[model samples]
Target: MGALDFISDYFSISTRRKKRKAMQTVDIKVKMDCDGCERRVKNAVSNLKGVKSVNVNRKQSRVTVSGYVDPNRVLNKVKSTGKRAEFWPYVPYNLVAYPYVAQAYDKRAPPGFVKNVVQALPSPNAPDEKLTTLFSDENPNACSIM
Candidate 1:
């Protein structure tokens, strides 16, 4: 019986231990008006299991959490504190090719950041497009070879 039990445990898929959550950072945008708001938001997230650290920047209205926790769960935890919370939607301006595009620009975003949205114009200088345009009759600089 002991031998049979050992063999079953070795081959059974269900006997494997559950995998631990991976370390990750979750950034949330929460409007924190004052020190109290910051403390509340920080405490709410830090109390959750597996949270390693919490940072709140009231000026940017952002909370950064580092740990082995799900992002949605952290967002829900922030919302539970009666504050409107959402995932950070801004990316560095220099990272985007068309930073001034309608959907990507936001007046409310902090300096050097823009809303993360699909560019309105496809890249005009794409290699494939450049190759096509080089031989097309419409290009003024196209090779004169017929």
Candidate 2:
């Protein structure tokens, strides 16, 4: 075969492999109040073994985790953080949580609310401030789900 043909075939095989390896998405209902809390939720869930990405919408009170993973593990992971979490029972067929591309951040309290929060709070990751450290999953072997 020609060089171009060989390259095309090779790339197609690799692309298919990558697509097949893509992780599943599971959304979990989370309890989050503010930007800092949202950051903590994302940080915690993103550290999981099979987790690809985590998006937390505090205003909506939802956390969506996209990864080739199960809801139970994610639920357990969130609960470990002192927050109450469950697969959203509101969904029909008992869906864990409704999946969606996370939407806009609307801190739509009255005007000047967020600005006041910024002024009232310290800078992100301030040296003296303590941040929540997420726990490593109990099973280290599952991390290779890439």
Candidate 3:
């Protein structure tokens, strides 16, 4: 039985199976206007140490990065390009959805030194008192109610 089995058997060197590392995709909101700005933003993030790929859509003004890096670290990289960055809710951590919508954040800053001028902007919750800077204990980064 052993001799017959040995005579019928053939030997060949080959890999049994390959293990692949899973990658995660994180979406970010950007305020990209032109093609140049989009490219610049994409390049900045794609060049990161852990970033695997970058896809920027100008119409939606969003940047999606694929990798296994930390989300906070990726967000910081996006902000370095002079664009506001936040977590995108549409895209999942797994690779399934091909295209996802990214929300863009654009803010306007007060112009000139007249900045020292006083204003009578009322508080959102207070509704009667004025506020220099609105502070919310719950969500500090949220927009103030108008």
Model 3 alpha-carbon miss at residue 63, Å: 1.0
lDDT of 2 by residue, 59-121 (tens): 657788998767778888888878898775333212222122122112432222211111134
Report clashes for each candidate as comma-separated counts: 0, 3, 0
Error of 3 at 96 (Å): 18
lDDT for model 2 comes to 0.62
* Tens digit per residue, CA lDDT, model 3, 34-131: 88888878888878877788888766556778886667888898888888767653323233221221221112311110111222433456743224
Q: What is the lDDT of residue 57 in candidate 2?
A: 73
| Cα-based lDDT at residue 102, candidate 3 | 26
TM-score of each: 0.77, 0.45, 0.45
Q: Name the lDDT value of residue 96 in candidate 2.
A: 20
Model 3 spans with C-alpha error above 4 angstroms: 1-22, 89-146
- Runs in model 1 deviating more than 4 A are 2-15, 122-146
Candidate 2: where are CA atoms >4 Å away?
1-22, 92-146
- Evaluate residue 93 in candidate 1 and report its C-alpha lDDT on the 0 to 100 scale: 99
Tens-digit lDDT string for candidate 1 (40-124) = 8899999999999998888999899999999999999999999999999999999998798889999999889999998766667
